[model samples]
Target: MTEYLLYYWPGIPGRGEYVRLVLAEGGADWIDVEREGAPDGEPALSDILSDTSRHHLPFAPPFLKHGEVVLAQTALICDYLGGRLSLAPEGKKDRRFALQLALTIADLVAEAHDIHHPVAAALYYEDQKQAAARAAETFRDTRIPKFLGYFEQVLKANPDSQDWLVGETRSHADLALAHTVDGLTYALPNAMEAALEDHRRVRDLSRRVRALPAIAEYLDSDRRQAFSEHGIFRHYPELDA
Candidate 1:
């Protein structure tokens, strides 16, 4: 069995957490490259990403290397790992459904990040504080509810009805949603508290994912990274409702 190598930024969970959950649950033999401090730090991550030799180059971090294949993008990496690790939904239809769900979850994650960096990714939150506040208000009022409501309805509409987001079994999408929920709660506690109440199914799904055996252990382990200012989801009291 070829051990998987995950290339993600050090410290914060970010998009890598989504892929980490799958690897943890599946008991995959994987190594978190930069986190372990082997070759170097962010430089190694950047070099691998900019490597011109590879025809299929990934645009960013959170990419997974399996043998010669380098898969990037949180959604794509999660989907690829899910299937290989037996964490994916069975059959052609469910597989596509899970992928779509993961993609949708990614959209929500991006929006959550934009709340703090509404103007530009390069500018610090301090420079864009005023803009972030305005953007966050709309995000809390409209986007949060819309995305959470969609996930809630999706769970209710799932034919499996076994608490998983996609099919009966837990898939990459479910894991990703759980991670997103944790981030949202950390970043916008006030908004998430009210939204979670209205979205019980989604809440339960996130809880269920957290309660999984491997995940429970992983959460308590040193490997599990906490939510902070650097990650996609960030807490700025002024931005929250």
Candidate 2:
């Protein structure tokens, strides 16, 4: 059996949460290396991300180490894992659609994160409060509806099933969308409340994703990290509608 090692920031869920969700749903044997810590008390996340000697160094956290293969980027990691976990659709076209949906969810997540740090990710939110406010207004008013409505259409158009994003079975795209919706709800509750009222299919898919046996169990467990200001889906009161 190949034991998987996930390298991610210890505190916030961040992008790593998506990979964790897939692993949990697949019942894969994996260890969150950063959370566990090293035997010598060194931080695992920093060690791997900043390893100068490694040929394929990841620029950030949420990288996965599967034996000798180290994969980075959230969508790419999920795409790789989807094939192994059978979370992707069987057909090639459907698999591509699943990946496309997951990538779109990634874009939504990036926009959600940007609402708080509009000036720059390196700068503090306080330093860019004005810009963030502007960004938040646009995101809440326009971006949310556009992305959520697109997802709603995708669900409505899904021929195999309206419950899942790709086919009759759950796919990685569904999990990604669920996480994105949850993040949006956290970051912009008032906006999401209104948006979801119109996007019934998107909302229903989110509920269905949550109701998955493994997902529901993990959500209730301590292993699942709570969303906070430090994470992508930050709940800054002023930034929300």
Candidate 3:
């Protein structure tokens, strides 16, 4: 068995890709449980989530099962794996700093997803088209600039004066940021094109991450699932403007 078993829905990068990026960079021995497990991925995930016998049951997918540990939420999972895989900075405070950034990135991701499903996640896009368009305008004009610019300033103001997001080296936070940038650019091409022009450091950091040997290889592999309408960063034409 692989050292790590990742439970996430199949067919879309979604929140799971953020976890995947750190795993790729760290070269951790891991497997996508649903993709490699039984054909009914949801049932398998539910089995684990609903396992009352387990003390640590995750409420949703994108959880990782390693040994007797089961971790949910992207930030927590990345923090755990990054530490074990040597992708974390030393010191307690610095690790918390990385988590802080990861949480912010998570906030941005949630907002992006809500753009397409502003009314309700349970409602279809067609049913919420008008609300989504309204939401998209604000997201493209406000939220994107806010989150991306915040990260750019964070890189610029790194006390260590390094290109990485935390301390003097790359941590899980940087990987999360890189994946967030990719998702944003994919979901909002026109807006991101304009937004990225001013956030040069963030853009460069993402580029550097993508150039990492392991990350580049994983990106080129068949395991990499491309962004789609079903995922968080859905690219709706009306929402693109």
Q: Rate the local accuracy (lDDT) of all candidates.
A: 0.89, 0.88, 0.88
Model 3, 79-112: lDDT tens digits are 9999999888888999998899999999999999
Best by lDDT: 1
**Pairs clashing within candidate 3:** none
Show model 1 residue runs off by greater than 4 Å: 38-43
lDDT of 2 at 202: 89
- Residues 1-241 of candidate 2 have per-residue lDDT tens digits of 4377889888988999999999989888888887874444333777777778899888887899887788898988898888999898999999999989888998988998999988889999999999999999999999999998899898888999978888889998899999888988998888889999999998988999999999999999888999998989988889877
- Writing each residue's lDDT as its tens digit, candidate 1 over 150-238 gives 88888888888659888888999999999999999999999999999999888988899999999999999988999999989999989
Give RMSD to native, each candidate.
Answer: 2.2, 2.0, 2.2
lDDT (Cα, 0-100) at 3 in candidate 3: 81
Mark the 10 consecutive residues where model 2 has the least summed lDDT: 36-45
The regions of model 3 sitting more than 4 angstroms off are: 38-43
